[model samples]
Target: MDTSEFNHGHGGEPINWERAAGDNAFVFMKATQGTRYKDPWFAEDFAAASRTSLLRAPYHFFDPQSPYDAGAQARHFARTARAAGYTGQKPGELPPVLDIESALVNHRAACPPHTDARQVAALLRHIEAEFGVRPVVYTNHSFVTLCLAGDARILKGYQQWLPAYQSEPPRLPGTGRDWAFWQYTDRARVPGIPGPVDRSVYHGSLQELRSMAGIRGNPPER
Candidate 1:
């Protein structure tokens, strides 16, 4: 599951890490947005999640139309995430996530500004270089089809975290590509969280999840 400050206001209480990690194998939380803001609860929440032994990852909200350079934004995300204690070296630590949903760009407006897919890709590459681990791409179908049309190729090797709220599985953008994580619902009532929490499923076994996070040894038997 993943959360940000926006979700906290809607009956979202401080997360009970042990209770939340009971049914979840991985947890993702927003660390930074654009090039300016850091989530106030990130440091505390991250430490809590780590203490629970849930495989954890921090995501950055991408703002393609922001005035800052893409490289700058990537640096901001890496620096903030590292400062928040994401070493990308622990057994249960997953790579950083890049949130590219259209909601970040006001896509519902009458006329959304064009987002350059190349620039987005550049940011991802820069982050990968900075962190020494390939980041996961979190995006919805529409953004991939519309804003990133003809340019999705730049994201060729990255794992995808797709959100499709239907009962059916999501259809990913690239040919032969599959989802590494699937955000199945945003209104899920998880035990440790007070209100609705976005829930996702890792697309592999516990061992595979550990491997994806670059953990070296045999994972403790679940």
Candidate 2:
């Protein structure tokens, strides 16, 4: 239930792909969310981390724009993440994610801004076609309810990286779509950072996750 308190990660930490093969799942040290994206090291770190057994994905924080051009942002992400030389199996090893924050929509929607899911879907499809990999969605519970509440059709297919602060995130209820991972808490004191960091867990077995990453062969159950 200690959701807001994620994990720790700042400097360099030697990632052991095999060791990470444990239930550690993955951690998305959102670089773009802050000014960190401009630093080349962020991209390098992302690449190195993706090589590990844990599946690593990078995301962009979309701040107030029409859904029409959103796919372009995702495309830029695909290009940048790759050009930065983040190690991976091309499109499959790592997924590009869209982080829709409060200002993502022009101005705002309403008390809870409603997003055009159909447009969002087209953007996602464009990303997949352009990059050969499907993108994941990251959102807080509040924004999710506001924007994606009624758009179950597309939500069900994509991976949901939900941030449920101070409480355990809601799991897939009667909804068949299962959450691939849960960002349970932040400030986990994970080795590498100056301060604390954010930590999360994959909803399924490591092998299943690997499969999602297109590892080709099946991995053992962790």
Candidate 3:
């Protein structure tokens, strides 16, 4: 599960971390937007999730159209995530996520009129360089096909978090490639998270999930 500032304000309710953990939900929360905004509840929410023993990651909302340099945005995300207690030292914890979606284009006034795959690549490179592990790429199939023009080969080394809210699985762009995490529905009713929430499933076992996150040992006999 993942959440953003939009999910922390008036219309949103605080997450019941204990309940979520009990449900075996690993949580990822948005920590920054572009190169400017920071999610206000990041500190509190991150700490709460950690205390509940939930595997956690902090994601950045990438805006290729933003005037800010991709490198700068990457630096901001790294800084914000670190401050929020993501040390990138534990394999049990997920690496950062880069969320690129069509909504970035829909908000044209704030973002540029066009999307740049190169800039997106730059963001990915910077994060990987800073953290020593590749960040997960979260995007939909259409955005990958249209905006990226099916040219996101730069992200081939990283895990893909594809969101296709339908009965069937998502159709990936590149051949011989598959999703590591699939956000299958946005109307899921999970315990602890108030109202509807986006729900995702990992492609493998708990041990595989840990390995993908860069953890090397067998999962602690949980």
Candidate 4:
């Protein structure tokens, strides 16, 4: 599930992490955005997920228009995630993520002029240095088509989390690279989550997923 402070259970109840674990393999939580604005729900939600069998991770919402540079944002994200207990070396903990999309910010319109591949690449590199593992990239077709021109050599090594809602798996807009994780739906109804939630699938086997989290051996029992 891809969740931020905005998502809530029925009647604004907190999500039942135990219930979520029963239905899902992993949980991606929003940690930080730009150079500040840490998700209010992130620390609590990430800690709650730790007790469950679910693999948990954090993502940063990249803002190319921010006054701070990519390095500052990366540092802020890494610090916030570290404070939230995401070490990336722990069991069931995946690497940090960069959420770069053509999305609105603080009631503003979508950003078309500020998107830069250099910034994205620099941010990813800084994050990888912090965690000692390759970070993940969460993006969509529109952003790629509008900003990245469908091909970014800098993105080749990082895992791609493509959100394309359709029956068929999505091809990475211009790169023709296979998606590592696919967010197939935003209206998925799981037992633990009251409102609609985004759900995604990992392309490889359970073992491969564990490996990505720096874990070895069999999948953790739920």
Considering every candidate listed, which one attains the maximal TM-score?
A: 4
Which of candidates 3 and 4 reaches a greater lDDT?
Answer: 4
State the displacement of the C-alpha of residue 162, model 3, in Å, after optimal TM-score superposition.
0.5
What does candidate 2's lDDT look like per residue over 1-222, in tens digits?
A: 111112223344444334443545555544443212343445655655656655666666554245365565556665666666643355335566666543434665442232555655666676677656667777654554465663345656778777655776774332356566677666555433435556677777766776776666766455
Candidate 3 off by > 4 Å: 9-12, 65-68, 104-114, 214-222
Sorted on lDDT, highest at the top, how do the candidates line up? 4, 1, 3, 2
Which is the leading candidate under lDDT?
4
Instruction: Provide the lDDT at 53 for model 4.
Output: 78
For model 4, the stretches where C-alpha displacement exceeds 4 angstroms are: 9-12, 66-68, 104-110, 173-176, 220-222
**Candidate 4: how many backbone clashes?**
0
Which is superior by lDDT, 1 or 3?
1
Write down the lDDT that model 3 would get.
Answer: 0.76
TM-score of each: 0.89, 0.69, 0.86, 0.90
* Clashes per model (N, Cα, C within 3 A): 0, 20, 1, 0
Instruction: Summarize candidate 3's per-residue lDDT along 118-142 as a digit string, tens digits.
Output: 7778888898887888888887766
**Candidate 1 lDDT (Cα, 0 to 1):** 0.79
Runs off by more than 4 Å, candidate 1: 9-12, 65-68, 104-114, 169-171, 216-222
User: What's the true lDDT of residue 1 in model 1?
Assistant: 89
Model 3 pairs in collision: 65-112
What is the Cα-based TM-score of model 2? 0.69
lDDT of 4 by residue, 24-123 (tens): 8888999998887898889988989899878889999997555338888888999999998898889789878899888665865354545677777788
